[model samples]
Target chain A: MNTYTNRQWIYSKRPENVVDERHYSLQTTSLSTTELKENQVVLKSKYFSLDPYMRIQQSALETWERPHPLDTVQGGAVVGQIQDIHPSCREFEVGDWVLSYTGWQEYAIADVSGLRKLNRDEVPLTTALGILGMPARVAYFGLQDVGQPKPGETVVVSGASGAVGQIVTQIAKIKGCHVIGIAGSDEKTKYLKETLQLDGVINYKKFTTQKEIHLELKRLAPQGVDIYYDNVGGYITDAVIDSINTYARIIICGQISQYSDGLDTPNLGPRFLHKMLYKRAKIQGVLARDYNNRMPELLEEMTPWVQQGLLHYKETIVNGFENLPKALNMLFYGKNTGKLIVEV
Target chain B: MNTYTNRQWIYSKRPENVVDERHYSLQTTSLSTTELKENQVVLKSKYFSLDPYMRIQQSALETWERPHPLDTVQGGAVVGQIQDIHPSCREFEVGDWVLSYTGWQEYAIADVSGLRKLNRDEVPLTTALGILGMPARVAYFGLQDVGQPKPGETVVVSGASGAVGQIVTQIAKIKGCHVIGIAGSDEKTKYLKETLQLDGVINYKKFTTQKEIHLELKRLAPQGVDIYYDNVGGYITDAVIDSINTYARIIICGQISQYSDGLDTPNLGPRFLHKMLYKRAKIQGVLARDYNNRMPELLEEMTPWVQQGLLHYKETIVNGFENLPKALNMLFYGKNTGKLIVEV
Candidate 1:
């Protein structure tokens, strides 16, 4: 029997704010070939997907039984190659590439349920972390299903140049809905209209006045918006809620604005409750994990779009595992455009 | 044709607050014995379901709609006999009893889509306005589905002695849940535990401190409340929002605390949002109309429980159509238990 060792990112202590270098301490541990469990696969990290959801898992969802003495690596996205596999794990062969939620580490051991066999030939394995896996599926399901975007209806997506928001805006356009993209910068805003082909784009940072923000949104959504994909909460959420048309639907995929502060109690303004009644709207928080059943269909739907150059992706790649914290910080500050990737 | 003209409760102007006689002016007119439109039914009023919903309707859902003239009637509950029916209206007969959304009126005309023909012996006709109709179905469905109560799970229903709250508490008990009812008065609180058979009851008016409120709820719900049905908003809502268990579900049926002032925006202190994420709880606002397809099934589930004397109801009846305004005011003020009915 061969012995194998792996570096695992474990949640050490709960984070109290934006996850900084101080919140995580990376350590390399060894495993003997004899210690490998049945159905375990040793994965060599390839593509790492940085997401806002990782913030919650490190701070709020660290309920594991492992007794840790504070700082350690926190968990989330990694696309990797299977270096070794226990025979009991029949899902993959030793050389197969896979996307696993292995966090910020060079290598990790995963049970069969956590790894999905990757077909990089259809779409590159790296795309699996961004436009093809969680963000794409979140875009596919959140807009098409939860937001219930209808043709000719107006749809607005905030954080438009980011991984999830970029796909959401494009999908809305494909469905014949008038898409409006709201981002923080002029360059990303320009790219949204010219590159992504969204019907309208707004650089939200310019509108310091509520009246201007309201008027700009109203101009973009003349008939009023039928769907709002709220990735950014606080004022963006407030503006979107106020602008919704009758029977509008909002899919709350993430609250990037609030996440930085570590999900504090949000001041939900009054008009929101009133709108929920008058517009007969629905707002639901959804995690992509819940849509695991639809992954095959999602890859199928998004395949042609990516291949034909209909769907484009941009990656801000941090070359070493050591810079994983910096990559994560980029996402928290809204500095990265498209997907933030760590290549080890 | 013998003419005994019909009258309607119409919204003359936009109401800025809880509707008073000043906000309304009843108009009477005679209808010609002319041919009816397809899918139409002419009805004579028996009981109108005066609800907090009418307050929104009276404002024409405005803060959200076009600057159109006030609607023909200030909406309320109504049960009436079919006075006439369009030849294409397949569901009704001249003598059939039907419950409808016909406003404060002695008589009204409705389309088949808005009318539900009633079976007299199955439950009292008034049940359409109270226990066996919209309010009852809301309590039943919201609790059974969203609340997902289990035996020993603590469920709190605020505005506990109102029309919907009374039914929610009873249904929770039927499903083997420990029920806690919150009302405004001691008399209503006594009725909640003794007559309504709730496991525990609290009068929020008596609990002066938010800490006391939390402590009392913590005592009754030692395991932490699994569900909260919020009918009344304001401090009571804030207190219950704090006491919920992880993964709790809140069915937002009404916020009577905001109905009277129209301008009363309950400031949910900023931390409530964090509670939602940390608790992984769900808060959903449900309109009974959206649950229309389940009405027959709702009656079937509730009737047997109601017939076995397992369900009890109380009504604060005010006689005459003139007192309709007063009856509805009681509903907003949280001054009545069970359903408030008007003997027109």
Candidate 2:
């Protein structure tokens, strides 16, 4: 077999505050003999997911359990085709498209347990990294399990144009909730209203102060929000939380606003207890990984919706393996409209 | 029958800040000879309940539902003897003791539906205002329904010496959880540990700073707290929330800490989203009245425990109807060891 080179992004240093390419090192390694261990299979990645969560792993932040150390391949979910497999491995065949947490590399030696084969004929393979995959599952579980939006209830979603937020908005809408999407730019808010047909869109950029945000939220959710799918937790979340009705559900899916600073930044919002006590609200946090075992149930409900054009998704794909850092930074700046991915 | 005079503390003015006697006025009204309204009963209050919730009604603050207007009789829960009833009323007897939301008055004319008859032989009549009544019901529902403490889990009770908090602590222990009580005084803490048999007690007054409280919490709850029954919300809550374990349940029962100032004071605690996201914790607010229909189930379980000496309660009773304001102020200052009540 002809030798192929594996291009990889390695974590070199921790980002002080905002992450950039300076935090990672790109290196190339050539395959030798194409040998694999007993349970390992060599897979060639088609799409590398550039998620906001990747920044947490790269920074050695305490945001997640089992923090990744420096000088290791940047770990992330990737859609890949199996090029070779060990004779002992029974899970895959050559050219089989599979989803795996194979990191930022072209080819990875993965175990059978680390990969799940996907059918490209049924749905586009790249969706395993976006709409039909982990992000979708996050939105589904978070919106349903935590947010629990009832019919006719107003559901507010922050970071409404991002991968998870978009799905969260659509799912809440599908659940018969009056969904309000809060985004940074007019472009995002406009797209959410015009394309997704959301109930309302509040461009947070137009509202500079907390009072402004509060007023905008009051206008959008007149009776106060019943469900809040919080993606960007800070002023936006505080504003949404301020307008929550009694028995409101605030689901914490991501705190991208604080993730940049490793959440060390001080929050000057009112203490949660008083408001919670008065409203009898429930604020719950959800991580997609925690609900991995329940994916089949999520996909069972979501797949038909996607197949029937009831659910929509967008991808901001940066070509080439080297653009991983840039693609991820797009998430931090709110530049991406939907799923931010790197196509290798 | 001889005419009787009804003396009442009317809500003369809205308290600007900390509630005092200035907000209330003593007024007397002679019983009219008018025929009794259907289903109405004349109640002579034996024990007037001066509760923290009463302060909320006394203030024009935006906490709790259905604000009270000035010059109305100050509304509160009370244990009273039936003085007279309408000829149409068949549910109650003239000498029967009942629990009623009769406000701060020696006598109140109430509808039959507004009162629940009490059994003084099984438990003390005054307990209908306290441990065997509203406070106990709050603790039972808040702890079991919201907190849901698991066996061997660390359960922290804030305002641990207060009526609801004391009951919550004991119930958590009965559920086989390690109970930690956070109180304002060393005397309260000692009572929690010695009398209530709590696993640990933190006198919050001894810890002036959040850091001090956090360190002490870390040492006591080495594995982190699994459930938090938060009655007093502020620095103590912030510290406890900081050390919450993954999937921890935080039940917000009351915010007595902020009630004194009508929750106007800004809290400098860390924002909850990031930590809650990482831990996947659930923080819920509970109002006992929301679970009012479930009180029969709570009392069924509690009556046996109280009768068996497995459950204990304390009350700081201020004598005479005149000490209502002072008795309530004692709740604000954390002067009461357990339930704070007034004998009329």
Candidate 3:
């Protein structure tokens, strides 16, 4: 075996205010010369994905303020190549490209269960994390199964330029829903409408209030929205709920507003459930990882849409593992336009 | 020509506040012998069942508050005997017993489209409204389908002494779940435990806080409540949500607290969505009228249970059509246990 070194980022300490250079410290460790276990493979990570969910894990100790924790190497997805595989690890060959939950690392030991052989080489490897992997899968099933958008019905997606929201908008469009998107910037609003073909885009920064929401939504979708894919569950959700058509469905895929800033803080937006009951609406909470059998079903459905040029995905990739925090910070601040990933 | 008289309560005007005798006025209306139209029948009401949903219909001007129209006599279930039938109405023969939405009246002109001919006479006529009709059917479907209780689960039913709650508590018990009921009084609590066989009971008026809730639930269930059948959607719902186990389901069949109360009044307690999301729970809002096809199925399933001494119903009957407003008031005030009805 060739001599090698594996540099990894381990969980240093739980984050308090914000994740910076200190919250996660870079530690370089030597590769073990010990015999490889069966069904294990040594892989070289080519790219790593940074996401807001990690910030949730970083602040796990914040008492319902943050999400749960992972005790091992900070978990994330990586596009990697199989360097070597033990005899028991079948179906993978040396040099085969694979995606694994290897986190922010240069090279890592991957368990077979966490690895998937990448297909469709022309599509950028980074798309695996955004439009093809977890976030995209979330948007795919969340809108279809949970939101249950009907053709020609009005559909609204918050965080439109983010990995999940972008795909959700495009998917709704393909299904013949009148799609409206909400983002925080002019460029994202333009991208959502011009590039992704959304019917309307609302910059939440430019306007707020139930009245403004009513007027804008009426102009864009006069019939009223039937399905709301809620990525940022705060006042925006409240506004959207206020404008919902009867028996509307809401997919609570994430509460980016609360999850990013932390939950226990006084900055969190007020709760919204009365609106849910008033409209006789449904709100479903979900994660991409929870879509086990659904993941491949969605991937199969989306592959054709992407191939037919109906679906598009954009990635904002940062170079080097040291920028992992920066790439993830983009997610928290809503700075990154699509899926945020890091190349090592 | 035969003459008929109906001593009925009419909705005098749109309800400006919680409905009382002021919103209604008792008047005697004489009916001239008018010929029954096609698909119509003439019926004399034996019992008019008063329900919590009457409150929802009384406040229709509130935008979301869907109130029944003024002077429509306000619709609800009535057990009646068909006095005459038109040539086209073959489903019900003259002198056959039937259940219909005949409103607050001694006599009703029923559209055959909206009436159910009673098949099983083994049970009392009042059960047609209280347990075997809309309320009981709502309880059965809401708990079985929406609440989705499993064996060994714990179910918490708010308004546990009311028409729907009594049936839900018993059904949960039949499904092998430990049931905790929230009623307003000790006598009703006794009815819940001794008659309805609920595992535990709480007078939500007395105990407060998650601490008291946790203590009672811990002692009774220890395993945590797995399903919440919420009828009174206010403080009691808050307590039930606090005691729910992960992945628990809440059936939002009625918000008795919100009906006819002014929009801005203090009807809300704790917002339920956060706990719903964190617990991966499901909350379903239901109306029994939407489940008409299932009525025959429900009657078939529940009749045996009622006849074999497994299922039972409680009726709080107010004598005479003059007492319709008072019976309705009793529902709003929580003064009547189980279904409140007026014998017309």
Candidate 4:
């Protein structure tokens, strides 16, 4: 039997604001190669998905469901290589690449039931944690079923350069809708406009006041926003909502801006209630996990777009297992341009 | 030709905060028996529905569309007597009772195209302005379609003693839901519990802190609220949202709490966005006018409930056209238990 040293991040305490090292303790542990249980696989982490949703998990809000026990490893989507598999695990081989919602650790003994085998050669294996995985699925399912972007309609996406937002913007464009991307940085706006060919772009960081954001939104969506894909909820969502057309659809997948602030986060605004009524808008929150049953359908629709050069993906990789805390914080500071990941 | 003096409430100016006399001018106008124009009928107001929606008309907010001209008669739903009809109008005759958005006036030269003929004997003529009219239809359509209350689902209604709220409570009860009603006054909660037979009642005015309201809601909706019929959007809504269950449906028919305060109204609080996401809830704003196409269908379904004495309708009538402003203001102060109307 072979023994190996494994580095793991354990939840220490709930975060008060933005997460830091104080919220977690990285400890070196040892694991010995042992006989695998039936239908179980040994997973060696290749890449850890750094997402704003990770910040939600560290928060103390009761609404933030703890999928794992406290003081256990902090959990995230991990693209891993199967090290050893039980004889009963027929779906996966020892060398097969896969994705699992395994916690932040160098190695994990995971049930095959939660593992999805990945075809690494077709695209980057890290995409199993990103574009071809959670983010793309969220973009496809939320926009198709929730936003329902239609031809000639105006669609505004906040966090427009983030993993899910970028995909949502492209999908809206592919559907023939006029896409307006709202990103925090000029570089992000440029990427969305120059690379993605979004119909319009708003650099939200350039706006100082709510009125400024509202004016910019009105300028970009002259016919009014028919669909809003909300990745960041705060003043950006407030401004987009202000310009919504009749029977508009608002797909609320994330509120990254408020994740750190928790329940004390201010609402979109006071007029949000009235604006909703007058516009007769529909606002719904979507969880990609809930739509995993339709992942094959999502892959069918989105894979062609990527292969044909219609969809482009971006990655912001932070190297090493030790950089996990800093990588997670990058999401809060808007330092990451697209999908943020930590390579182990 | 006979001439008569008629009093009319005209929109004088936009309200600064809550609507007041400065926003309206009671004018003594004159109407004469003259040959009617094509599609024009002379209407004598019998009962005027002075609703919270009228306050929206007086507000300076641009989103609240003024369907009628300002400095003219203040528009509202009115139950009227057809004193004379244009010869070209074959659908209505003199002495017919009908419902029309004829504004706050004793007489209006209305277009026959906008009138809905009413059977005065089938129900109280004023019921055409209350239960059997817009309020009831709003309750029927919004609850049935938007809320989608399932049997045994926990349903909560804010402003539960108001026109539409009371009806929504009854319909939710009939649908076999565990009904919880929240109102501004204790009397309102008592009526909802004793007369309406609601499963639970929360007197919102009794709670000084949001925590108190939240605790009470937790006690009442032990399993969490599945359906929320939002008639008032303020702290009460914040409390209801706090207790919402997964896949909750929020039917946003009215936000009477903020109609007076306009855009300055405080939000349902910061936690609302996260709660919606965690619960995968649906929040939709509904206008009864949008459901007019389904009016006959709604009436068909609800009429039987009313006839069988399964649904009880209540009205707060303020006699005379001079009291129009007073009657409309009652809705803002939570003075009216049910539908607020002015008998002209």
Tens digit of per-residue lDDT, candidate 3, span B1-344:
55687677788876656677887877788754466788988889888888876666665433345657886676778899988777787667888889988787888888998887775468878888888888887899878887888888889888898999989999999999888998889999988888887889988767766457657667777787788888887556666666777677778777776665633343433333444445566676766765778887998899888889898677888898777776787777798888888886
Report how closely model 1 matches the true complex, as a DockQ value: 0.24
DockQ of 4: 0.59
Misplaced by over 4 Å in model 3 are: A1-7, A12-22, A33-35, A55-72, A83-90, A260-280, B35-41, B60-66, B82-96, B119-121, B242-247, B260-278
Off by over 4 Å in 4: A264-271, B264-271
What does candidate 4's lDDT look like per residue over A1-344, in tens digits?
55668899997777768887777899998876674678988889989998877776665555547533568898889999988777887888989999998879999889999988888667779777777889988889999998877799999999999989988988888899999999999899999999999989999989987679989889877788899999888877877877888899998899988878754444444447767877788989998888999999888876777667778989999999998887888898889887999997
- Model 1: how far is B8 from its true place, Å? 7.4
Per-model DockQ: 0.24, 0.64, 0.25, 0.59
Writing each residue's lDDT as its tens digit, candidate 1 over B235-286 gives 6777887788766778778877766664334343343443453454666676
Interface RMSD in angstroms for candidate 3: 4.3
- For residues B27-52, what per-residue lDDT tens digits would candidate 2 score against the true structure? 99876425458998888888887777
Question: Which should have the higher TM-score, number 3 or number 4?
Answer: 4
Off by over 4 Å in 2: A1-3, A33-35, A58-62, B33-35, B58-62, B262-266
Top DockQ: which candidate number?
2
Ranking by DockQ: 2, 4, 3, 1
- For residue A12, give model 3's deviation from the true position in Å: 4.3
